[model samples]
Every structure is written in C-alpha cells, then in structure tokens.
Target: MEISTKVQIVTKTTTYHPPLAISSFPSVPLITPFARPANCGGIYARDPGDILVIDEQPESSSCYPPGFATDESSFFSPGLACPSGYWSACMESTGVNTITTVTCCPIYRSDVSLSCVDPATLAGVWKSQFCTFIPARSVPVPVTRSSNGRTSTTTSTLVNPGGINAFGIRMVYQSSDVVTASSSSSSSSPSSSTAANLGPDSAGGSGLSTGGTIAIAVVIPVAVIAAIIGFFLLRKSRRARAAQPAALPAQIEENPHKPSPYYDYKPIFAAHQYHGGELPTNQASAELPASSESPVELPAEAQRHEMR
Candidate 1:
C-alpha cells in the first residue's frame, strides 16, 4: 500500500566571498656549514673534495673518457663523488701552489648571479656575478738602487688581463670504469650450420646433472617416508581424540579469603549487635567506649507486659 501527502517546498539563495591572503618571502640565504677563508676581497677560496654539479643532458660534459669529452680533454679529479658539471676538461698543472678542487655559487640557491653583500663589497678584486676571486701577479720591472746605481728585477705571478693570474682551481669528476662480460651463448658459426653437425660447443646450463639426479633420488624416498609418518601421526591423533571423553567445564572457584581492594571494614562492631549507649570497644588495646555506657531505667507506665 502507498500513501501520498501534499507538501510545500522552499529554497534560499546565498552568496560567498573569497578569503583575503597575505603573502611574504624571507630575504635570508641558505649557506653551507663549512668554514670560509677571508682574503681575496672577501671572496672564498676553493676547498678540496668539493662535489661539482652535473650537466647530464650532454654525456660528453660528464666524467667521460678522454676521447668522449669536448676538444678531447681528459676527465679531471676522477675521485670526485658526482659527475663533473659544465667544466669536465682535465689538466696536468705544474705549479708550487696547490690546485684546489671546487665549484662556486651564491650563498642562496635562489641567487643565480652569485651576487651577495660580502662578494659585492669588493668591486674589481671580486667578481660578484661569477663568484670568483681574482688573484694578482707581480711582473718584474726595472728597480734602481739609491746608494748604488744598480738595477734589479723580480717576478711574481698573479691575476692579469683576461684571468691570467687567477688562482688555479680544478673540478672533481666521477670515476668512469669500463667492464667487459661475455655470455656463453652458442654461436651460429659462419663455417658450419644444420647441414654439418660440426657446431660450436653449446654452453652447459643448469640442466639435470649426475649430482642433481642423485639428490632427487635421495630426496624422494625421504619425502615419501616423512609424508607417510605425518599421515599416520595425524590419523593416530584423530583416533585418540575419538576414543577420549568430552572434557567437563572448568569450575571457577572464587577465593573466599580474598581481601577487599578498597579496605577492611569494622569487622567486630559491624558484625555484632549492641544495645543503645553500649558501644563496642577493644579491651586488648585499652580503648575507651565510643559512646556513654550509663544505663537508663524506663518508667512503670512505659513498661508493658505481654504473654507469649
């Protein structure tokens, strides 16, 4: 059966407003924890064992073999952890000063131009955009002595025009190793084919050999005996269960002497009944009665006599 009733419907319209947002960006830069040495116009010197960024798109730019690099330059710093980036060329530099392995960048990754406060403070000595220190060289000029008319000359190497005396730096590249492996695949000899039985010796794979056959022969009997023993044990257990009587439900005997978790009650006074004004007392402990023990006599009129 179905019942129908008339009803009125109502709808309401509503409007929504977007929320206001406040955006901000921090000006601080992220710097590595490594210590920086100050000298060349606040520009840091290249440190040893620095990981260089890799330019992966061009394989030749990476730590490839000498033949694969651009201009056939040998890969430098083969001990570096990662692939050498844009600069992959290697060199055998002969100089008394050390050739530091390094890469330069602004303190913050966001700053691509490598411009910063310390590096910017030095105008000519430090290249802010490139983030490098311009080392100086001392070329010997004619020096005249005041006491004696004698001329002397001394030479010192430093940075000159077109990055001449800039401190030498080398980038570390990933070590490239070559390995050769030959698979034991039977080759279709150009000399012999199906017409001639003289074919290249086929490589032996994990085929069933004498040892494997012996192992299978030894394992089958042991497996069969184990299965038979397991079946018999299972059947014996079933028979034992069928012969046994159903076990009775265990009786949950509660502890009658279990102490109350809360506390022990007034054992003697609560259990025994006493007349009015005759309070219970502990005679052994010499404790006085809690109430007055004086007995009061009832009037003759209040006394009633009843025969049972």
Candidate 2:
C-alpha cells in the first residue's frame, strides 16, 4: 500500500511542532501525533495513555490511513471501545488538528454534521436518531513494516459494526456491494472457472432463500392461528356440554302399606253378635219376652193347644 506524506495546507487553522527538536532532550520530549474521535467533542493535549472517545468520521481532506473510520462514517457504530485510540474529525473542520483523525469524505451539510458538546451530552448527540450510545467491537490485525531492512509486524485495530433496531431510519444504498465484489474478484483472478463460479449462482441462491423464508414466515403464523382456533372451539364444546342439564329415568308409583277400598267387612261383623243396632232386617218380625208377661206363645189352633 502507498501512503502520502506530503504536508499539504490541509487546514487553515492548524499548526505543527518540529518532530525531532525536543525528542533528544529527556526534559522535553516531542508530543506524539494523535487524534481524538470526531464525536468526542474535540481533542485536547493529554497523555498518550489517557483514555478518550472517537465519536465521528474523519474529514477526507485530512491525511488518513486507509480503512480507519469512526462512528459518524459507519452506518452503524464500529464495535471499537472508547479510550483506545484517536478518532477522526469531520470534513467541516477548518484545519487539521494533530489531536484527531481527518475524515475521508466531504462535509455533510444538510444531511448530517458533527459538533462539540459536553461528555454528558454525548449520548444526546444522536437524538435525531434512535441510538443513545454507540456499541463498538475492535479487533487487532497484523501490520508489517520494514524500517531500514528490519521488518516487524505491529497490530492495527479494526472495528466491526453492530446491529440496529426496527425504529432506526432506513438506510438505502445507491449501489450493491455484490457488484463491486464480483468485479474486483474477476479482475484480480483473471480466470474463466472463477468467473463462471461467480456468475448466476448468487442470484439463484438468493431467490431460493427468499422463497424459503417467505414460506416459513407464512406457514408459521397460519399454523399458530389454526391451533389457537382449534383450542378455542374444543373449549367451547366442552363448556356447552358441561352446562347442559342431565336427564333421569322414568318413575313408577307404589303404595304397598295402604289398605284396599274393595275389602269385605263381614269378617269384623261375624266376630261378635250385635243387638238392636246391629240386628238384621229379617230379625225384626220376631217377638221378644217382656217384663210383665213371662211367656207368650203363639198356637196353631185353640184345640190343638188345649190337648197338648
């Protein structure tokens, strides 16, 4: 990779101290060139080990190494943690401040811009968007350098971006990354087999994937709805059955202890002789002895009676 070291008039309000003037003197060693992250308000003179935050993208006009970026440049926050390294200034910066990295793009005027705010208000900086704070992930990569025939590998950190929520503003890409990747691969390899491998495979695979995803999305919801409906229907049927009145078997009347109305009364009458009140109608013609007369007889004839 080629690096540009020309000290152009990158900014109107920037200054630089002699690089080696104070290095030899232990009492006054030259300050190392470093930058603060753009979103971290602004940078100030501090110890190299001092922790700081990089909040925004560096300006394009400022000299910057390739592949380094801050929160403002990335559509998402790079997972890089704060207080690790210097962040770049936005392109709107009037001059290059040695304390921060420079942006690689033009100053975003109407669409977006960077400004200085208190550290406590840093979270509020992105209030225009839903994001309250940036979550960054940093990984170290090997950077090999040869100094006067001595080659050494040093670590250069890279940040991986994180996820966003559904409420975030939609990001639209003017062009697809697949096109650039395919073109770059084809140009570098210069092989017929490689070109064929990269051809319509992606399109076909993406289509199939989309179809499968759609099927799953549609089927899962339908199945869940059906199951819910079935459960409710079963519950309703059970409840209706439970609430219904139960039936009982027919009944027959029985009076085993009661006397019958058709019973004969002769058996009670024959047990004891009844006089006047119980006399039979035929007995009324007969005469009975009186107190005055001892015996009263009735004869068949007067003569017959005297002979006897």
Candidate 3:
C-alpha cells in the first residue's frame, strides 16, 4: 500500500501612513552636492509670523537679505527656516566648507488656499528680513506588487519632525508570505511474499543485536559482583590468619626422679621377726662344762668298789 499528503499556506501584508503635503523636487546642479530646490515655490522664514501671503506677484528687482536666497537660487548660509505657512524644513552639509544648504516645504493647511508661486514672482518679492525661499519636502509613495508565487506591499512616511537642520523623521512598514514542499519519502511497493521474507530476516538481525547487548550488560555486572565477593573472602582469610597463635619450639621430657606437682612419694623399709635365745639354722651353737673336777673323782671310786 502507498499513501501521500500535501499542504498549502497563505499570507498578507498591509501598510498605512498620513498623506504627505508636497512631492520631491528634481536634482539641481550646484557647487554643493547636497543643495537642492523645493518641489514648489513658497516663502521660507525664521519666524512663523513672517510668512507672507501669496495673493500678488513681487517685482523682478527684489533682492533677498544678506545671508538669504530664493528656493531656486543657490547661496551659502549657516542656517535656514520655514515660515508660518510652511510646516517642514531640512538642511544638509558637504563638510568641505562650513556652508550648509537648507530646503523648506509648505504646510498642508486646511485653513488657507495658497497655490505655489512662480520663481519670477518669488524673486520680485524676495526680502532678507523675512525668511528665504528654499526647496520643498520629499515624501515617499507606497508601491504594491503581486505576481508569480510572491506578493509584497510597502508604505512609508516621515514620523518625527525635529527641526529645520535635523533629519528626525522615521519610516516604518511590515510584510509577510508562504512555503510548502518538504523533503520526505512516501511509501513502499506491493510485494507481500518478499515483504514476509524480509520481515523475518530483519527481526532476526534485531534480535541478535539486542541479545548481544543484554549479554554484555548482564555479564559485566555479574563479573563485578563476583570480584567483590572474592575480595571480601580474601580479606576475611587474611584477618583469620593474623588472629591465630604462633607455632612454639619442640620440648624435652622431664626426669622421673625429679620432684613435680603432678606425682606423690613415700619412704620404703624391710620387715624382720625376733626369737628368745635360739638362733636360726644358719647360726652355730656352743656347750657348757660346770662341775667338772668333783664329778670325775666320784665316778672313779664307785668303779673300783664294784670290781672288788
């Protein structure tokens, strides 16, 4: 069996701004690279109240102040300003010399209906005491495009106005889009018998791999346990050996005649019996001879008598 999938995405972008009152002027040829005229002719002044009305044209003989010049005329000055009716101004410097070029633009006033004046009419009415006539303001237009697989829209506007000499205005906008295709495989073929054989082989291979890992894990722990047991046994045996008494030298047997606490002793004598005036057969006896002389004489007399 086989399966497939697809995805789609979309995005949008929008931008808005307060409309600009004046357009950008064309580039002009001048000694200073940053010097340019305004998009329209209008009076520029240091003080807001000094801005004159555009009801009548001034004469051609009019001359500006010592340090001021018309919007179309090029002159050197340290600073510039927009009059009461003008709402914005900008100044840029080349840094080659200390001279700065100033440009000014008319305000988008709902209260007044003053149209842009011609350069000749402006020259005829030029006054140095009032403000100088400089260049107009530069405003950006929004552009939108949608083609191929992409779409984009951009809008811009000046946000902050600091002063005549500073570029304080900021521009901001937003954009968004889509992407689809991904790098992933789909499915497999429809061969049931082939898949069955392959499945067994794959399962066997996985089983073998798992078996090896399990064997290694079990064997390592068992070996460690055995080693620990053996170490304990060896230590116990050493302690037992240290606790046993040392072997003594050989001893000789003691003499039997010597007095000792283990044996007792007594004195021995022979037994004898006594008889009165007789000796044993192993003794010799002696005879007595008392009236010897008298007896012998008597016996001799008697024998003589008998013989007679």
Candidate 4:
C-alpha cells in the first residue's frame, strides 16, 4: 500500500553573508542538534565574534603515532614553534628516579582542516583548557649497600678531577714527567718483561689467535712428515747410488763341468797319419804329459801308459 504525503518548499529574502561562511556558522544558528552543545562533529570551538562554536577534533590515539611525536618535539625547545598544522602536547613518564616530560602533537588531524594553538601562547583558549600539564616533582636518591654488607642513608658528593668541557669530553693532564713506580727500590723489570711477553705484540691482547695456533699446529706436523719422507728418500737414493758402482765390476761365472778354456789346441792324429813303417805296425799307445793346460806345472807326473 502507498500513502501520499504533502511536500512544502520555502524561499527566504536575499541575505548578505561574508564570503566562504559556513551555512550555519558566524551568521545563522543551527537548529537544536541531536547531541547537546554540538555545532560540528567534535569539540567546542570559537566564532569570529565571541560566539560559541564547534569544530571537528581528531581522535586521541592519533597523537600516539611516531609522526606526531616528531612534530611534538617542539616541547623540547621552547623557542621552536609547531608546524603549520601541528600543536605541541606534553606527555609524562614516571621513572624509578625521576619523571620525564615528553613533547608530542596533541591533535593529529593532518589530512583534515582543524585549528591548533600552542598552550603556552594561549592562556584562556579552549585548547589549553582541555589539556593539562604535569607539575615538577622532586625525587630522592637511591641507597646502595657496601661490599661489607653494610647499608647507610648518608650520601657523599663525587668530585670530578677531570672536569668536562663545553664539548662534553673529560679533560686529561700529564701528572708527572717521570713515572712514580720507577722510584721504588724494588726491581719491576721482571713484571714488565712478563707483561711485554704475554702476547706477540703486547700484554693487552687476550691471547694468540686461534687460527694462527691451529695453522702452526697443522704446519709443524706436515713439515716434519715431509722432512722425514725426504730424508728417507734421500737415504734410499744414496744406498742405490752406492750399490751401482759395486754391481758394475761383477763378472759372469764360468761352468765348472767343462774343460778348462786355457788349454793348448792339438789335433788328434788319424789312423792314416800314423807312420807305421818307421815303428812297429799298428802301435796302440802314445803317452803325453798330464795336465798340459794346467796353470801350475805338476811336480812329478809323467805317468806311462800300457802298450797294446
């Protein structure tokens, strides 16, 4: 089912208003809004002519980001002013010894149009009214116990012999031209020698480097093994070289069963070569001296053969 309703349109006379004036601000008052004291979506603001106004306020969490914290750095330097859209805010941190005040941006409405004022500059502004500052508080010094297990409430002031200069570096001075320890009667040469010999360069070194030690340990054995192998090889070569000369004069042994090679050669006479006419026919024996090829002459051999 459809129900018909009447629609009405009304027109007003031409009214003069400043350029860029809001439809309901600095000129006309908006009708009763759903929320009380609401002129805009956020907190109370100021009008040009001392009239109460309202404008958009950023979320409280926006001030916690790192970007806003950097802009709020204006809190550190009193002379520095906040950037065009940023406003300085003070944050308090309670420490064990003291409370620290950190400056930060209160409203993080960077993308949107909003008003930001310095709390120091504006004494009675709405921005200052909403923001509160922490007062300076005094802190007591901590009590420390001595090594002897004794505790005391009293404190002692420490004096700095080497005072810091404008650059925050401690000033150093040469106490005396000569060392005081040298004047002592006792000899300190042994201790100085020990300190100097502690490391390759100086006693300040913790110890020899592990890599160098390991390299030395590995190289020494390898060098020893290589030396030992070289020594044995050289010894074997010398023995082999010595044996070559002795082997050069070696002679081949002659066969013992064969007749001596030093014997004189004589051809045996044939039966036709024997002269039977001069002697008895068919003479069977002709004796010769024994051992004709012997190196030494026989003392009294000349054995006679039997006649056939």
Candidate 5:
C-alpha cells in the first residue's frame, strides 16, 4: 500500500502599523519602595561583583537607609559620583531579587556599571538606572516598536507615586546616540553660521564706542583747562591796566611882548641919538639906565615946545 501524504507549509504574516502617538499613553505612577529589576528589557543584567552605592543618610533621616554615613563621600570614590542634573539609582541583590539600596547619589553611568564602554564612540545601547533630574511630576522616556519590518518611536512618562515630588528612579535606555548627535548638529548649524557672520560687526561697534568715549573724556578736560587759563590771563591783564597812573596836560606861559605902533622905529632912536650928539647939557640925559622898561617918550606938545 503506497500512500503519498501531501505536505503544506504555513507562514505567519504580520501587518505593519506605526506606533501610537506619545500623547495617547495615559500618565502612570512610578513604583516606589523602588526595586531594581533583574533585567530591564533584556538590556541590563545585575552582575555578582556589582556593588550598590547609596548616599549617606543621617540617623534621623526617614527616606534612606540608616547606619550609612551622612556624607556623600562614603558611597563612591572621587570622580565616580554622578554629574550635575543626574541622580543615582544604586541596586543591591537580596538573594532572590535585586532591590535599590539608595537612589540619591549624583554619579555617572560608568561609576556604577561593572561593564566597560567604548571610549572612542558613544554609539549603541547603554542601559542604566541613573536618571536626569525631573522637576516636574513625571519623567518622559522614549519607547520604540517594530512590526512587519517597520519601526516607530514614541515617549512615555513615569509619574511619582510617593507624592514627594522628585526625580524618577527607573531603568533608562539610550540608543542611536550618534544619530541623535548628528540631528542636533544639523539643526544648530544655521544659528552658528549667523552668529559667526555678525561677530566682526559687533566687535567693531564696541571698539568704536569705546574710542568715542575716550575721545570725549580727553577733549572735554583739555578744553575746560584752556578756558580756565584764558580767563585767568584776561583778568590779570585788566587788573594791570587799572593799576597804571593816568597822564596830565602840559601848562602854558603868557607872552609879555606887544606889537609896536610905529611902522618904522629907526627915526625915533636916530633923533634921540642926534640930540645926544648935539652935546646935551645934562650928562645924565645922554646915558640910559639898563632897566627892562622902555625909554620914556615925550608928547607931541612937549616936542613942539622943545623945538621952539
């Protein structure tokens, strides 16, 4: 009996659909008395040699483990602490499950992780419990889904359950760092170019403003000093002129001489000399005194009588 059995192959097919928008996911509270999972989406696994580092708590503290030192230095070595804007989520093994021992240390991923990362490139998936500080009520994380060879990405927020508003403590996955960095660089290129173009103008403007201010400061003082000196010199010149003595007018003397009435006075002197030549009887009459007064002149009648 040769019986041939027909063989059939069945393959499952899936239809691709984009992930729902990040806004669609309702807000969910974060789990508290927070415990670290054994595996977070198959990305991170707790190693046996891994040590849980936690912030030191005081005896009176209620949020953290007791008996730990109150200072943050007790948790890790220098430079191992988380950087600013980040907080640590230290985990410890409880024989059955891993739990968070402390969650308030400021440390980086390499400080807590036992595994080593490539220093040359920050590409690939890096899983850690450390989170960025979230001042808001919730923390947002990106989530991706792949269906029928199609992939999509969205974000979901983790809410605080303890009502004590603080940063969220959860596993965080960072993937495709290179792609993110490239996108950021491309977006920032235009702004950087514009700033570069405006740099020279801004520098020139500042230099011109400084030079103008210096010139004003120097010129104003020099002008003021010159004016003051000029004022002083002018005042001194006026004072000198006022102190000098004034000149007086010259005095004139009166003339004592008068014009003679006779046009020719030679005859009078000749006749007087002739009378004297006739041998005047009196010697005193012939000689005249040397006085400033003119000689006495006889009247016409007296002259007629003398002629007679």
Candidate 6:
C-alpha cells in the first residue's frame, strides 16, 4: 500500500506574541534555541519554514492552506496577509520581529494520529501534537476589484479588535452577498458581530436595564391602585356629609298661633249682653256705650272675666 498527502503553505502577519527568552536556552546559528528541561531532545529556534528531522522520520517544513500567506509574522501591523482558520500570535520577548510557525492536520478517526515536528524542543512553549486552532471570532471585509485585477474600491467596512474570545469561534461565513462589515470607530480593526449583538461593544451589563424595567412594572400598578382607593374614600365621605337633615328656624318655635289675646276685647263683649233692668219699655231712649279710651269703669264680673 502507498500513502499520499497534500501539503499547503500559508503565513500571516504577526499581531501580538510573547518574545522567546534566548538567555534561558543555548544559542545556535540560525536557530533561536530554548532550554526545555522536560524533553530528551533540544528545541530549535528557527523561522516558520525551517525544517527539523523528528524521531527517525524525515524533517517537515511549516505549511498553510488557501486564504493565507507564507511570509509575514503575526507581530506585523494590520492589513497584512493571513490565512483563514489561523491567527497570528507574536512572542512578547521577540517584540514583533520573530515568528513561530504551527501546522495542523485533520483525521476522521481516533486511531489515526498526527504529531508536531518539534515535540521535544517545544515542550513548554508548544504541544507535541498538531491540534485544531480555534479562534473566538473573525471579522472579514470585502474589497471591490475591476476586471483587470485592480482594486476599484472597498465596498464593506471592517471593524478591528474583533475575534473569538474564551468562548471560541466555530466558523465564519457570509449569510448574503450584500452583507456589510462594520469598522471600528477608532481604528481599522475589524469588529465582530458579538459586539453588535451584545449592545454596542461586548458589554454584558444588562442587570441595570432589567432592574429598571421591573421597577417600573411594579410601581405603576401600585400607584394606580392607591389613586383609585383615595378617590372612592373621598366620594364616600362627601356623600355621608350631604345625607344629614337640616334644623328648624327660631321664629316658628317662638310663636305657636296666628294672633295673640288683647286686654279690652273681653269687656266689650260683656257690655253688649242684655241686663234685667234694661228690659223697661223705652228702648229708643237707650244710650250707646262710651269708648274705653275715655276711661270707662268696668263691673266686678267684667273685671273677673278680664283677669281670667
């Protein structure tokens, strides 16, 4: 049986990576060696494409696939060429001038295994196997090109400082042809959709918002209920006060009858009555009674009647 494999090479500009401590390791020409105490074989400090023979096997060189470049390190500035599915990490010690290369391979089954080329040398700084490098996110921008391969314009904007976080990114793909990219206001760094979905920059402070909404929801009903109760109580008090009776006037109680009795009226009525001596024959000679105003004297019986 014969084995076949396809190799691809890619390189990306270095963004940020820690520098390699050359003082800790022995120095060699063209190889920045690091002293790793755990490994049996010494690690070689070489560029991304430098070859190294591993455990009785032939040496392998650094490689990358499509959508990637092979020359730049991650420490370089923005707009530098990089490959999809891979991100550049610059060494803090190297100060953006050095590059560390990584290679990856996929297997469908667990029985098949792939290993890193510099396992003994990269014991601390790198692992012994080529594993999948998953990033948190990716922000891609589009550039318009003419028929002659000249860039006419930039149709989409790119946001920077956008990428996967600790959560890791699964994949990045365009949902539509008319999709537009958003660039960061401060710089050319690409911003991620997560920033937009999480309310303008990935700030997860929703507790304040929820608290405000809940407070409003709770207080409005209580205020309405209090207002209704107060209205009903006020109306009931007014109705109770209006239902009471009115009091009687003083003039009606003081005088019970239409007219009052007088002193001289009784005497006049007695004088008009007939007496026994007055029955004599000459009725035409009878005289009319004088006015009380002239001080006429009253009989004893008339006086008793007036007193009563």
- In model 5, the Cα lDDT at residue 56 comes to 15
- How well is each residue in 1-308 modelled by candidate 6, as lDDT tens digits? 99999998885433221221121122111111111122222112122332221111112322222122222121112111112222222111123223222232221112212222332443332333222222234433323333454435343322333211110111112212002212112222222211111121112211122223445799999999999999999999998887653322344357755333453235545545676856645345758988767666767675343554
The lDDT values for all models are 0.27, 0.29, 0.29, 0.29, 0.30, 0.28
Query: Number of the top candidate by lDDT?
Result: 5
**Local distance difference test, candidate 6:** 0.28
> What stretches of model 6 exceed 4 Å from their correct place?
1-208, 244-308
Could you tell me the lDDT of residue 70 within candidate 1? 19
Cα error, candidate 6, residue 93 (Å): 45
Per-residue CA lDDT of candidate 1, range 1-308, in tens? 99999898975533211111111211111111111122111121122211111121123322222222212112233121111111211222234223322232222111111211232343443332222212244432222122245433233232343121111122322111000000111232211110011101211111222233445899999999999999999999999997665432122125545443345534645656666886655334467758667788878788577998
Candidate order (lDDT): 5, 2, 4, 3, 6, 1
Output the number of the TM-score-best candidate: 2
Candidate 2 global lDDT: 0.29
TM-score of each candidate? 0.17, 0.21, 0.16, 0.18, 0.15, 0.19
TM-score of 1: 0.17
Cα lDDT, model 5, residue 60: 43
Q: What count of clashes does model 4 give? A: 0
Task: Provide the lowest-lDDT 10-residue window in model 6.
Answer: 163-172
lDDT by residue (108-195, candidate 2, tens digit) is 1221222222223334333322221112555443334445667564554534342111111111111112233233433332111010
- Looking at model 5, residue 164 earns an lDDT score of 11
Better of 1 and 2 by lDDT: 2
Ranking of all candidate structures by their TM-score, best first: 2, 6, 4, 1, 3, 5
